[model samples]
Target: MLATAQALIGRKVDIVTSSKILAIRDASNDPNEG
Candidate 1:
């Protein structure tokens, strides 16, 4: 049960990190926003 919980948390972290990276990329791509 502990391992499963760890895996779930890890997946959520990965998703959040990915979305953050995409947001940064999008901001960089738009000159008006920067």
Candidate 2:
């Protein structure tokens, strides 16, 4: 999902480190938090 978001936005995300995001880790299972 992170790759998809990056593709759509054409750039990497700049979210905070402690942000509770789906793509925060590589073992994420959610597909809607990128």
Highest lDDT against the true fold, candidate? 1
- Looking at candidate 2, the ten consecutive residues that score lowest on lDDT are 18-27
Per-prediction tally of clashes: 0, 0
- Please report the TM-score between candidate 1 and the true structure: 0.38
Error (Å) of candidate 1 at residue 8 is: 36
Instruction: State the weakest 10-residue window (summed lDDT) of model 1.
Output: 9-18
Deviation from native of the Cα of residue 31 in model 2, angstroms: 33
Q: Tell me the whole-model lDDT of each prediction, alpha carbons only.
A: 0.63, 0.61
For model 2, how does the per-residue alpha-carbon lDDT over 1-34 read when each residue is reduced to its tens digit?
7867886877866554555564456337665655
Misplaced by over 4 Å in model 1 are 1-18
For model 1, residues 1-34, the per-residue Cα lDDT tens digits are: 6656878777532223458778888778976953
In angstroms, the error of model 2 at 7 is 0.4
